[model samples]
Target: MKKIMRSLGLMLALLTLTVVVSACGSKPLSQRNVLKTDQQSKTITWGVKADTRLFGLLDTKDGQIKGFEIDLAKAITKQMLGKDAKAKFIQVTSSTRMPMLKNGNIDAIIATMTNTPERRKQVAFSNTYFYAGQSLLVKKGSSIKNVKDLNRQKGTVLGVVGSDSVENVAKVAPNAKVLQLTDYAQAMTALKSGQGQALTTDNGILYGMSVQNPDYVVTGGTFVSEPYGIAVDKAQTPFRQAVNQSLKELRANGQYQKILHKWFHNVKGFDYEEAARE
Candidate 1:
């Protein structure tokens, strides 16, 4: 009996030690240094939207995602991690981007994410790389011209889930009913089916949609300023600073302007020049 008790005590002690060691081995994501890891790996994985046109879109032909945000991420990665350092992209939606970053699936988020105070609490943001504003898109002959029109008619507005557009619409047009879809593609589809009077989102994005569907137009211009930023994990201060520095360099070297022109020069109803850094 004495020997069996001693054996049981030893097993419990070993189990406790193992548990303590396992707990110590697992460090929180906030404590990990993403910059150092990226440097060592010679790659930075970016979480980008695969649906937002003009910002990030998956080209069905080549099965590759391309757009202004993808170009910008490539430029910034090259600028920060040497020209040879590679930039990898992982498709993310508005609803998944934050959770992906928090889980360390991607190093940063360069999607068309607005830098609002609420988001700032969850992740660190780089300087405003792009400036956008909220706007409405409607069929060319539609009577809805703006937020006020929606309010007067008490119409339904289409917005993407996990985007600020619906909340903005609610604030600006309290009478308008908002239908939040899973993504821009679905919202656009709902608009075409006459489910909603207007599709609301960033003006840049609306312009992209208009380019593809000539029958639609961005109406009422932009009502709210939405400055876009690159989001990193909340603990990734060094990576965020590095991104900000790269943006500054890109602006000074004229690369930023070139990229903006590449994507927006032909986009109707959008002033690409206004987005240029002075």
Candidate 2:
């Protein structure tokens, strides 16, 4: 009988310890000083898109993701953590970026994420770093010229899952069906495969897609404003502030303009001068 009680007590103690450890492991990242941690480690892991062109696309030749956001992240890491500090990149999709940030997998998100009221409730965002607007992409010579045309034809629109573009499309074209894909590459492929009549996303992304496929064109000028911002875990004010400050410095020192021009100067129809002014 004593041996039985001893075994029961041991089991109970082990269970209690498991619970305690699990609770600590699941603690909210907001309670920790992520900036200090990054400073100490001298590395900031950034969540970036690996599929979107001109913003963050995986280069098949070099196996490195390159584009506007990648350059900006490098500049910001240097500005915030000193030139010697390293910036690590992790591929994140619209569906995975936020969870990765909240779970402490990445230090920050420099992907083409828009700042919306709904998203603001989940994670903190830095000041507007890039301005874009929701737009549609369609194959050349297609009858669908704009959002209204989609509604008129009751056509289907492809959107990336977890992005506000899907919600925006619903608002603009109530009659049109929206098919959410995993990422931009999939959406573009679906569009090519006749799965959807139009692909809706930020114009910047659409532009990149169009550049890759001359057969597609971004039409129906922006309907919804999409101001892009860098995202960090909620309540990390010091880290957020550092990001905002770095952006300000980048703009003032002309580094921002240089980066913008480097990627966007040759993008047909994009007004690089106006973007620089912004």
Candidate 3:
């Protein structure tokens, strides 16, 4: 009787565990991937940055996130989900976006994320949407003209934690010391406080920083190529294909060019013509 009771208790425990596991199964547009579900819901959620201007930033006056990436996300959402589809934007940083994507917190990531081998292991990426390059930010009169100039014993470069820029800085300026901060804002503060001689990151991001602070300027045009792409969960084949198709359509319709001009036309030294290439 004791043996039979023990067996029954073990079976009950196993059943309870199975029930919990089934209840916590994978989320939608992921393992259970469905583009139609989003269409039916009339809404698509997108992960975007609220800090990176020209890419994505919050418009304080309107209390809405706006930028090239945001516009592109909206266009893609419309292209996939119909003209009346509503878009929900969630603020994400370089560090948080991928995890949020895996957890199904956002339907897609249009954030300025670079496609890399390591990242590819975790998520599926759409075709290259934008071409960016790593560059440096320094005080207006600072002598740091390029990546080569930062290769010195006393040279220190600041980058955000979880950003590829920190490792790239070592590759480009091997002799320079590197410090990783929490985010771009902190890295910029360190640069301004003389914590580091320069803040290194994507040229597009550096350009945004320069726009906000006239005292700083981006120097040394792109030491490394960083192509940005839209990210989707590896299982979301339908959604991924839709995003790539939308991108091709956007280029064909000249809407891509219109978006580029809307945000980057006023940015000095930005080669809008070259970026127009699909």
Give the whole-model CA lDDT for all candidates, comma-separated: 0.91, 0.91, 0.86
Q: Which pairs clash in model 2?
A: none
**Model 1: runs farther than 4 Å from truth?**
1-26
lDDT of 2 by residue, 190-273 (tens): 999999999999989999999999999999898998889999988799999999999999999999989998888778889665
User: Can you rank all candidates by TM-score, best first?
Assistant: 1, 2, 3
Choose 2 or 3, whichever is better by TM-score: 2
Per-residue lDDT for 24-104 in model 3, tens only? Answer: 774454556557768789788999999887888888999999899988888888888889988899998889998888777
Per-model TM values vs. the true structure = 0.90, 0.90, 0.89
Query: Which regions in candidate 2 have their CA more than 4 angstroms from the true location?
Result: 1-27, 273-278
Pairs of residues clashing in candidate 3: none
Clash totals, every prediction: 0, 0, 0
* lDDT against true structure, model 1: 0.91
